[model samples]
Target: MIKATHRPKHSSIPLLALLLCGLGILALGTGAVRMSPAEVVQALLGPHDETQARILYELRLPRILVGALCGALFAASGAILQGVVRNPLASPDIVGVAAGAGLAAVVNLMLLPNTPAWLLPVGASAGALAAFGLVYVLARQSGEVLPIRLALIGVAVEASLDGLRRLILVRADDSIAQALIFLSGTVYGADWERLFRVLPFAAVLIPITLLLHRRLDVLSFGDETAKSLGMRLEPARLVALALAAGLAAVAVMGVGILGFVGLIAPHAARLLVGPRFGLLLPASMLLGALLVVAADALGRGLIPPIEIPAGLLTTLVGAPYFLYLMRKTGRVR
Candidate 1:
């Protein structure tokens, strides 16, 4: 069980938020063309230089917003999945959401390149929902989706989807760059439209996830305890999973396969703020925002004009943490 920390638990919220704010400033000021703090501040207020203003307003600001929004959404989704499954290892990636989105996104990019740009998100969202529905159904036994069953079935489904993705990649010779962009995950070309694409889901779903903190808290006590406490386990689980999938889907739609933020951010928050869902959710969001924005900054500045995909950096970092978590949770068991 996750107990409250020795230090003040709530302090993490502000600390994370402050850190995120600082990173946002850093992201705004440092890129291909460096700007001083004062210059960035001035640009925000309105700048006479068209070049500076365009770089700040048209290039930097939108990517930062989309990165932050997608990061927060991914964290909220991860937190919800972890709570609902009563598994510290659970995340949107673990439960087939990212796999679904990735597969659908690849198909859209490769097969339907001529379709409207907006259809990518729509197709990806539908694919995510379909994968979840399959997992939910296949995992059900006598109307109950056991956590173990759900996890196992989800992994199988995800592996199968991944196989399909690889098959598609090998057989195709066209739209490889476009396909790779969604698969690799990036905020590189993010602009006002991308920001707008991801904003609504973050605004709506994050609040709903917050409102369900009591349920998440209750669910964390395990299945029998939730049932004994008069909670409808199946209904609540479905709802939480739906929200989690939706949050993850939009993120995949907006950027690409950013699988690790959902996994990493929640545990980081829980370690600092404890497992209380109310605090954990918001803290995860802030940390996730900070994480992606920082990753984007790192990618941009790491190689100068050459940028790394945000997903690659996150997976590089989150993969080790995931192994550590598996071992830690195993030892506890």
Candidate 2:
């Protein structure tokens, strides 16, 4: 009798989720004023010493939560975009949403340095929506948006807007620190205030995206096929784009322009879960949260006094993967 081999298929989602939880715990416990697991739990459970409570609740926990939320939102946006466009490389940053939000936020930082904190996200959202609208218009022909054309036009717009952002930064004064946050991508100052600012948008948009997961799977097929199947391809595509871009915009408002989470998370999730949006969507969210939190933790731990921005770390990690992906797909053109 031949020995039978029974190999279980590897499941990454659970591991990724567990990793996110671990990273969150470490993020709360491993800062300058370290706390034990019991103390951390006590701080979380409340009715604890004032100092430890402040450290855990005010300083550390909010940042971790914000990073996790931003990562999940960015990943969901990317998944929605890739499915709608049927292009694996489609992401909010790649498609000009981040550049637009960054540019607008920077402009606000420059012009209205004293503007109420609440207005920053509104400006960023407006900019993102405008940029997305422009890409859609540029990519549309007769009445339909083409995938390749959308990608090409979005890339072009992203480059142009990025250049504009650089030019504005060079000329602007007294906004370098804030601009650096946008350019380098860090959640250094994430707090409950910023988290609350972003929560309403994510709370609403994320559920909507999850609900539309099936529609995304349908949209992955060509437009004619989708239409033949009684799907409203154009409207559905626009709604998905709006939701994805909105999520990215709100996250940028909270955490600055953390690029590549949207791009990388979806690809990783799809590879793990095989393109079924039902599984892929949640998997991307978990992977994304894990990536950002882990990157943020590494950024904090790599040097005691000095810290690297999470955005820079992600770019370092994501750019090479992106290049490899492009080469593999022969999609560099």
lDDT of each: 0.83, 0.81
Instruction: Give the per-residue lDDT of model 1 (tens digit) for 147-200.
Output: 888999999999999899889888876665554666577888889987887777
TM-score of each: 0.94, 0.89
Where model 2 places Cα greater than 4 Å from the true spot, the runs are: 1-15, 36-39, 46-49, 176-180, 331-333
Model 1, residue 161: distance off in Å is 0.8
Give candidate 1's whole-model lDDT: 0.83
Q: Clashes in model 1: which pairs?
A: none
Best candidate according to TM-score: 1
Writing each residue's lDDT as its tens digit, candidate 2 over 1-333 gives 212342222466678788788778877776667777777888889678899888777878888899999999999999888887787778886567877886787787888878676787678767887788888888888877777888889999988987998888887775545544544578787889888988998999888888988888788877877899899777888787888888888777777778689999999888777776788888999888888888887777678557788998999999998998888779556
Question: What is candidate 1's CA lDDT for residue 230?
Answer: 98
